[model samples]
Structure formats: structure tokens, C-alpha cells
Target: MPAASALVDLENLRHDVDDALDRHLTRLRDEVAATGPGTTALTDQVSTLLAGGKRLRAAFCYWSFRAHGGASSGAARDAVVRIGAALELFQAAALLHDDVMDASDTRRGRPTAHRVFEARHRERQWSGDADRFGTAAAILLGDLCLVACHREAGAALDALPTDVGRAARDMLDAMTSEVVVGQYLDVLVQAEAWGLDPTADEDRARLVLRAKSARYSVERPLTLGAVLAGASPDRVAAISAAGLPLGEAFQLRDDLLGVFGDPEVTGKPAGDDLREGKRTVLVARTLAAGDDDARLLVTKHLGDARLTDDDVAALRAAITGSGAVAGVEALIDELAAQGLSALATADLDAHGREVLTGLAHAAVDRAA
Candidate 1:
């Protein structure tokens, strides 16, 4: 391995992203604090949210940058690290708003930001509807994170050459827009009927996944890094080819985790996705099996706000018995293989390729 590979290693990437985020957020917190006492709440919550991620996005961006010959040290490397920080900030924004939309009570084993604010309101006997107050607060906080994301990104892009910087800036702007559209699509699907056509249901779910996560979480990060490195269209195209499938697999793993993941590990209630009535590809597969009973089970309990442990157990059994879990796992494996295959042929740094392979596996094979 070239010594430069060490700079993009997962551990090093995490440290770099975190360090950059800390510095940026600390300054932000101070700025908010300047407004008056307790004004730092938003920045505090952001800081806390930024602390827990695995930095997968950062890893993807950094490794692709090194692989496509961006830079390994000095100013260019710092710009890349700042870009990674911007990605993390955007992710934090997503988590905050997602919790509010899903009415999620916890995240990463802690009270979701809205819930935390809500509890404080109750404790203080505050006037106005505490629930509404909490929701609004979280939403504003999410908005702040969005602006902060743009700020970090703009600063970093300004440091690069105009052409490459413009390319990366465009990518970052599109990523935000795509994620917002995907979020609405997800909400719309949850509000409407599913399984009317299994194939359509799966396709719609995949569409939402691709826009909401696959591209933003995986493909764009890779492309952004490669673009910053001034990668030829051929190289950028190759990276995207690998990214899309791997990104699909990455989100598929998340779908599985949403239903089956342990709360201890995932920091959310078990079967929370079911409670939220997510029409994931897994749910589509169960219906696709043409099992009426499975369909009935999903229809009855999948989105029940008052679902109990027993109800969750029944739903799990129905899903597993219909072979949906296995089916999804099989798809994950196949998609991962396709991504790895595409990656195999890419002309890039040897060490970067090897690390990317490991990162891909690590992304798909995880407990939370």
C-alpha cells in the first residue's frame, strides 16, 4: 500500500471528518451563543448528532479522492476533509427531520431531538402545545444544519480551482435537492396504499431509496471526490457504476435493519419502520409472494401506532415465513457483487481499491 492510502483509511477518515466538524461546529456554537444564553441549543444538538456516525460518507469521498488522484496532503486534502464535514452536517439535518416526520422517540439510543425538547417543555410546564413546540424547534434546528452544510461546502469549494470547484458545488446542491424530493416521496408512499402491484411497489420503494439515500449516501460522494480530483469522465462514470449498486445494497441493508435490528444496537425501537409503515422492498417482496395471509398481516399491523411486542412478533413471522427477508438478503448479495465487479475493473490506485472493497463490505455487513 502506498503511504497515501493511510490518509484515506476508514479510521483516519473518521478522525479527519470529526475533527473538521468539531472545529466548524464549535465556531457555530459560539456564534449562536453570541445571540444570548441557551441560544446554543441547536448547535449543541448538532454537535451531539455529529458525534455518532460511522463517517461512511466521508470514507467514500476521501477514498475516491485519493483513488482518482485528488491530493493526500496540504491544502487540497484539508478542503476534502471539510467537504466530508459538510456531508456529516447534512446527514445530521436528515436525521433530525426524519425523526419528526416519523414521530420517532429515540435515535442512536437517545431521545430524539424533538422528543427531548418536548420533555423539557412538559417538565417546565411551558405554555402552548409542547408537542408542537418541540416539533417546530427540531425543524428549525434541521434548517440550521442545512445552512451550515452549505456554508461548509461553499468554503471548501472556494478553495479549489474554479472548474473543479463548480463541479463539486453543483453535485452538492443537487444532492440536497434530491434528498428533499426523496423524503417527500417516502412520506407520500407511507400515506397511500402499497402492494397494489408488487412490482410497482418495489420499484417505487427503490426509487425513493435511490434518491433519498443511494445517490446521496454513496454515488454522489464518490463522484464529488472524483470530480474534485479532476477525474476524466471515464473514471467518474466508472465510479458511478460501482456506486449505484453498492449504494442500493447499502440501503437494502438498512431496510433489513429497520425491521429486524436490535434496538440496543440501532438506537431506535424495534420494528420502528413497520410502525412507520415503510413500504420497503422487503414489504413488497412479501406481498409479491402472493400470500394473502402475509398481505393481511402487513396491512393490519405494519403501521399501527399502538403496535405491541406481540404484534411485532407476528409481523416478523409473517415476513420471514413469506421468504421476504431471505429474498432481500439475496438481492443485497447480488447487488454488492455487481458493485464489486464494476469496481474491480476501474483503473485507480491499487490501495484505494482494496480499502474501498473493505468499506463496501463494512457498509453492507453491520449490526446498526
Candidate 2:
């Protein structure tokens, strides 16, 4: 499997993209500066979350726009870039809040923004409990990013024709709403231990994964760009046909990496999702395999952070023996193939087809 970020030119693009984001972050800092150092802390928190990522969503939006006949150097292109940047800002908001919701301490191999802020509260011996301080700071910072996302998006859309501007706004609204709904479903599913039947649970997990990650990450971004570029209804449907399966494959690959990837490469601890009791399709399938001892091992150690190396090894053995690993891998191949077939049917320019093809391969073959 290739790395999640392996396809792009990171060094060259990073400098330009970072410069754009830095200006945005500086603006955020200046706006918050009057609120005192604590607000500045929040600004830094947002910047940190925004600083690193594959920038896949942004690139997808930009390229899709261009491939759909958006202008290269005119207002259309600039609007597309700003729209992409807005997507990145929205991602920052999601990650900040997601870390809090998941109680995840790390993101991209660093302390999550909330944790970083909370630690500062502790070292400074602030007035409130550090945990509470951290949570509050993180939530506020997340909200800030959400607002910034809209503001940036508005500025971007201002350059477009009124119809395109309205369409862009609608896309942003729908994307936000869908992701939040999916997120709520995810939290509710995990909180209630809702999946007990192996097949049923696995199905639900797959749906949740699609709604929460795949659509927002790939499908919607591509469609949004296409819509802004004035896609016909048939054209929009064609793009979606290609994007949905590919997006599913993308998340399935991510699920695989979450369980089996090397920490050094993935920047996430091995079996972290298992420890988090993520209720992924993989776990559902393992449970459904109906191995009593395997089920027992999962029930006992699945979400226990105190689980040792031996415990994780045992859990891995149980999962593998359950035949879920092979099943999931097969599903990944099926979804990727479905996407490629859909792309073949879509009315696409050469460049659009190429980009989607590259994305499909990169997504499914990704190690992280």
C-alpha cells in the first residue's frame, strides 16, 4: 500500500499552500489578539490543525473544477482555489471537534489542538481544571474555524456568477449538514453499542463510514466543484456515480490502515481503532464470524487502552482467524472496481478521467 499522501508534490505545493493558509491564520490571530493571550492560544490551535494534512479535499475540488472547464487563470480559477481553501478550513473545524468527541489525544502524529491547549492550562496553573479548559478551548476554536470556513467561502463565491455563487453556497451547506448528521450517527452508534448482530452491525458501520467520511471527503467535493462549473444534471449524476464507490473504497482502505498499518508510516499507533472500540466494519465482521473465544477476546480487550502488546497480538489473531480481514479486503477491491466502471460510463474529459483514475488507485491502494 502506498502512503496516503504519496501521489502529490508535497515540497513544492506545501510552500504555496502554506503561504496561503498562513495569511489566513495571521488574520485569525489578529482578530483574536484583542481577546487576550487565551484567544491567541485558540488561534494557534486552529493554525496547528490546519498546518498539516494531505490536502486531498482541496486538490480534488480544484482539479474537478478545472477538469469541468472552469477557467485556469481568471476569476473562476481563483474562486475554485478559495473554495478549496475553505474546504480545508472546514476540515480543520471537523478535526478539532472530532478529536474532542473521540477523546483522541493525537492527530497527524501530534497532540490534538485541544490537548495542547489543555496542557498549557495545566503548566500555567490556570483557574479551571485543565481538562475542562482544554475541552472548552477546543470547542471554541472549532467554532471559529467553522465561521472562517463560511467567511472564506463567501469571499470566494463573490467572484462567481449569481447562479454559481448560490450553487456553491448550497453545496457548502449540504456538505456541512451531511457530515454533522453522519457524525452524530457515528457517536450514537458507538455510545450505545448498537451493533450486536455481526452482519447487521457491519452493514451499519459501512453506512456510517460512507456518510461520515467518504462522501464528505471525495464525493461531495467533486460534485460541488462540478456543480459550480455548471454541470448538467446528467453530468452531475455521472460524476457522483464515479465518486461514491471510490469514496467507499477510500474509507475501507483507511479502516484497514487503522488496524494494521505501521505507526512509523501511518503516524497512528497500531490497532488504535480497536482500542477506541471504533465499531468499524472490520470489527463487526470479526464478531459475526461467531468464534466464541474470539468474541470473548474482543469483549474483554477491544476498547481497553491498558491492553498490552500481547493483548493486541491476541486480538489481531482473533480478527484474522475470524476471516473478516479477507472479507474486508475483497470488499475493497469490489468497491474500487465499481468506481472504475462508473468512471468509464461518466461523460468525462481526458483530464477528468485521468484524475479520477489516479484518485481511485491512490485511495484504495493507500497504506495510511
Candidate 3:
């Protein structure tokens, strides 16, 4: 296929995934409504949250299946789309829980789910602490999304060969386990930063990146697709090798954006990561390379929830002056090059190669 047509095909696949999610969510909402009107709010919240992402996970899964000689049409292609939708639903659950954990105020340019629920409580004049109510509701909603994820993925897997189904399910299970563990580590890192030794900062940050973001965001999704396509172990390994570095680069870029990206582009407040005291790779690098003054600046303001605009500006200056941003950019370039090289050498179809290459660039080089 021509490059333009290949790009069009990928876009169409993304739309199909969206349509699948819509249909699934509609069915869920209707089912819940039959149980109780109040219970349907969970589905409503998830549907709204799932509507706005770039769907990068789905694209990676779709193209990876194509790369592994999966059928392009009929029930096989539709099953892949369903799997993609399942990934999206799982992601939504993660994001909802993550926002609550981070005390995040916004997501995809809208109020976070917990905050939305809190506002709803206030609006209704409910008889409880609005914040607590919101947090509880968001947590339940996240759990509901997880159940939905399993249901969606199970149905898709049922259509695959037994071995492929087993492998895909295993990948999904691993992805979820890694993300949850990563999130716990993230919480621990922040809570223990003061007591922990500074020397392990970079290592800890990389560990969190791999677990919380990298594998689920790219590597596992690609491998899951390959598995569903009945690719050999060697093929899955090669795709994962390519995907891991790309996934790392993707999270590194996200770390950069979390600290320095424009709120308009990133759909979050500027300096939100700093406010939350996220021990990102950039911050670790800055701490390692910065002078005493820079270290003092970070110590004073890194986790200050009441940070003023001036404080944020000063912290930004300290981070920039430490050259950590430059270091991360260099790392991103290096990792991206490694990933592209792997893709170039991998035994994939010409169109799959082209789309995966584009996805690699999109993952690491986007503003959001």
C-alpha cells in the first residue's frame, strides 16, 4: 500500500476502535440502568473519560497484529479492534485511579473524575464530606471499569486460538500487575524521598517509568497483539525489544511535558508534577547534577502544594539551569534511534513497518 493509504487505514482502524468502545459502553450503561438508575453513573463517567484520548495503545496493538500476519478483515480484524477497546477501557480505569492518587484536578482538559464527583455532591447538597464522597465514588467507578475491561478482553480472547488466547490474557494480566506495583512505588518514592538516599534517584525513576507507564503504554500492547496473531516467540521478542526503548522514550517525553509543557497543550496545570512531588527522571537528573543552591531550591519547593507562580518559575529556572532537560532530550533521541533501528531490522510487512515507525515518532515527539 502507498504510505498515504496506509496512514488512512490506520486512521480508519482508530475510528473502528472508538466505535467499538461506544457500542460496548452503551450496552454496559443500558445493563446497569436496568439494575438501578444510580449505578449507571459509573458507566457514564467511564464513557466520558474514555472519549478523549489519542488512542495510541489501540493503534500500537492494531499495527502490531498486522505486523505479525494477522488477517486484515473478517472476524479476526474485528477481534483485534475489540482487544484495542479493552485496552482503552483498562487505561481509563488506571487514569481514574491515578488522578485520585495524585489529587489531580484535571484530565484531558476537564475536571478529574474524583473532583467531578465531588462537585456533583456539592451541587446536590449531599449529606457528607464532598471530597470523601467524590473519592469513594471515583474509586468504585475505577473498579467497575476494570471489571468491564476483563469482560471485553475475555470476549475477544474467546474468539482467538487457545494458545493465542492464553498468551494475550497473560500479557494483559502482567500489564495490570506492573502498573499497580509501579503506582505503589510512585507513592512510596514521594513519601520516602526525604529519608531515602539520593544516589538511587535515577534508578528509582526508571523503575517507575518502566512499570507504571512504559510496558503497558507500548511494549505489552504490541506483544499482546503479536500473540493474538499467533506470532512465534522470536517475533514477539523482537517487537518487544523495539517497543521497550520506544516506550521509555514516550514516558520520558511525558515526564518532560509534566514539568514544562504548556497547560493548553498538555491538558493539565503547569508545574503539576512538581506540585505533586513526582520523582521523575528529569528531577532525579537535576538533583544529581545541580549545585547546592539548586538542590536547596528543589527541597524548598518541589512538593509545596501552595506553591506560588513565582515559586514555580524559580523551580523551573533551577531545573532548566541544571541541564536535566537537555540530558533527557539527549536520552529521548538516543532511545528513539535505537527503537527505529530495531523496527528497520524486524521482519515485518512493509506497511506495518511504516505505521509502526510513524507511531514511534508520535509517541516520543508529541506535545501531549
- Top-lDDT structure, candidate number: 1
Give the runs in model 2 whose Cα sits over 4 Å from its true position. Answer: 1-17
Question: TM-score of each candidate?
Answer: 0.96, 0.94, 0.96
lDDT of 3 by residue, 15-59 (tens): 798888998899999898999768877787887899787788888
Q: In model 3, which runs have C-alpha deviations exceeding 4 angstroms?
A: 1-11, 194-198
Candidate 1 lowest-lDDT run of ten = 1-10
User: Going through the candidates in order, what is the number of backbone clashes in each?
Assistant: 1, 0, 0
lDDT of each residue in 1-368, candidate 1, tens digit only: 22333434544776778888988888898889998997787887887787778788888898888888766787778888899999989998988998999998888989999988898889999999999989999999999999999999999989888998998998999999999999999999887778788999999999999999999888988888899888999999999999999999999999999999999999888999989888899999999983788889897787787999888988999999999999999999999999999889997798778877777777777789
Please give the RMSD to the true structure for each candidate, in Å: 2.4, 2.3, 2.1
Q: Which TM-score value belongs to model 3?
A: 0.96
Checking candidate 1 for backbone clashes, the offending pairs are 109-267
Residues 311-347 of candidate 2: C-alpha lDDT, one tens digit per residue: 8888899989999899999998998899889877777
The lDDT of each candidate is 0.87, 0.79, 0.87
2 against 3, candidate with superior TM-score: 3
